[model samples]
Target: MALDRRWPLALFRGAVPVALGLLLWVAVTGGEQERQQTLKGRRAADLTHERRHNELLMAALREAAETEDNVAHRPVPWRK
Candidate 1:
């Protein structure tokens, strides 16, 4: 008799796994939606100071590289 009635028990046992999987899926998607909303509310690099800062950094790097090249390939003052 027990062997013949196993199908119902198998179905009942499966219910918890299905519910947990759905719950995890909903939680992950809900968190992602909240994160997207937060990101949309604030724009990076939208302020004036940020652009000027980046421009200054690029100019400094360019000047440094030019100086290095000029000094590196110049004849050693006493070698030639």
Candidate 2:
């Protein structure tokens, strides 16, 4: 009878800490997920800005190349 009565109390005591620990774990994981999402958004914005800059640079380079080709094909004054 004494052992049976003690078993319920012991089980309750053990379950309380386990339940609290699980709750704390969930809170920590949720915080980490929020931080990761914020970082991902910032990184995506940075990449978009970089892509736009690269496209502008590529256009400028193409224009310069065309100008260089035209200059090279011109007749030299001495040759004329």
**Per-candidate clashes, comma-separated:** 0, 0
Per-residue CA lDDT of candidate 1, range 1-80, in tens? 35668788988899989999999998888789778877766555355667889997787567767764554455667232
TM, every model:
0.50, 0.45
Cα error, candidate 2, residue 59 (Å)? 0.7
Per-residue error for 58 in candidate 1, Å, reads 2.6
Q: What is the C-alpha RMSD of each candidate to the true structure, in Å?
A: 8.4, 9.4
Please give the lDDT score for candidate 2. Answer: 0.81
TM-score of candidate 1 relative to the true fold: 0.50
Q: lDDT for every model?
A: 0.73, 0.81
Model 1 spans with C-alpha error above 4 angstroms: 1-3, 41-50, 61-80
